[model samples]
Target: MQSCFFSTSRTTNDGSNETDQEGSNKLSKDKSIKKNLLHENIYTIPNFLTFTRLVSAPVVGYWVLQGNYTDASILFGIACVTDGLDGWIARRFNMQSIVGTIIDPMADKTLMTILTVTLAMQSLIPIPIAGIILGRDAGLILASFYYRYISLPEPKTFKRYWDFSIPSAEVRPTMISKVNTAIQMGYICLSLLAPVFDFTGHIGLDYLGYTCAATTIWSGASYVYTKDAVRILHPPSNIKK
Candidate 1:
């Protein structure tokens, strides 16, 4: 009778042990699944910062259209700072995402292009300045098309230290591109502020505008030249030689 009792007790303990182990395994799997889902979701803090810039673009445009240069300048400055902050946060925190990459630059180009056109329409800035900025942007677009069609190279999957390929092909933004953006943003803010602060008549605005124009040209040219050189040196094997 005692042997029968001992056997029964042992069986019960064994079954309990098995159930506990299974539960532990399931918990671990659940945690791992949650972690993977979190990583795939792109709503990080840095991306939030980028979103702020996107939101500000329309507000800035509205203010400009309303002839409120002062408020527009302030909002533009905030957007510019947010751009820098988001990038710095992403790099520092390793929070870079494909969405952030696309939205950040799009927000910048949209805001600047709208402001440039609006200012020109108001005769606040010289038509020549707006023309030069637009011309550089158009040239970059053309070069991008040429690279895509004429130079059909194998898609590079990795970025090198000195690689400056356009982000449409690969999602990485070049350091020089970031610098150029910063300079352009600075110029826009200053230009907008000049009239609000009664500095439009001063010679400084002209000098700054000229400097901004030159930088735009140089940066655009460099982008095209770098992409062309990379395509030549590292043509994708899939592309015909």
Candidate 2:
């Protein structure tokens, strides 16, 4: 009888031990899954650089407004360099994210627009020229939003706006756009340097400014004239069969 009782007790304990191990394994698996989901993917090198540039926007504006062009130019140079660095890291490391795509351009636009507007208001740069650049950027922003809204899954409610969908809004700067960006930054830097070094006697700053303005208008006009912008603005209508 004692032997029979001992055998039953051993069987019960064995089953309980097996169940505990299984439960532990399941808990561990759940923890691992959660860790994977919440990993620090956003803290990548490229994103960090982009974030730094974004933060520099306000600081650059403050310096420009304070009449401290020297420091402003310094920080602006860092912003421009980081812009390229982040892009390079993103492409080389395959660490691109939708958030990066949105934030990167946003940071650039913020920096450029804020500095230009502040300087223009101070009568340091041409107001009409700044208007053109700002206007172009504003249009692109609206177009991006318009394209993005169409890409979402439509509601089941009886509605037919369009059939096709773009995956995401892409910010593909054309060759001229890229050149314009470089010249734009260069002109801003030179403008800032003019105050520090006194270049009123020369027309270098004016020359660069005119070039930047021309490129800005040309790039913007190219977008409008090209079919790309129109297609993005007006998606194809859904044809119900």
Candidate maximizing lDDT: 2
Per-residue C-alpha lDDT of model 1 across residues 1-241, encoded as one tens digit per residue: 4775443322345466555666689878777754443234467887787778777887887888788998898888788788789889999989876456556766777788888888878776688888988887776556545544433333433442113322223234455665766776667777678778877646777777787777777776676556433232232343232
Per-residue error (Å), model 2, residue 146: 1.5
TM per model? 0.63, 0.69
What does candidate 2's lDDT look like per residue over 1-241, in tens digits? 4775443322255456555666689878777654443232566899889989989999999988998888998899888899999999999989876557667878888898899888887677878878887888898778766656664334422233221221234455667777888898887767667778888435878888888989988887776666554232222343111
TM-score winner among the candidates?
2
In model 2, what lDDT does residue 122 have? 64
| Candidate 2 local Cα displacement, residue 94, angstroms | 1.9
Worst 10-residue lDDT window, candidate 2: 157-166
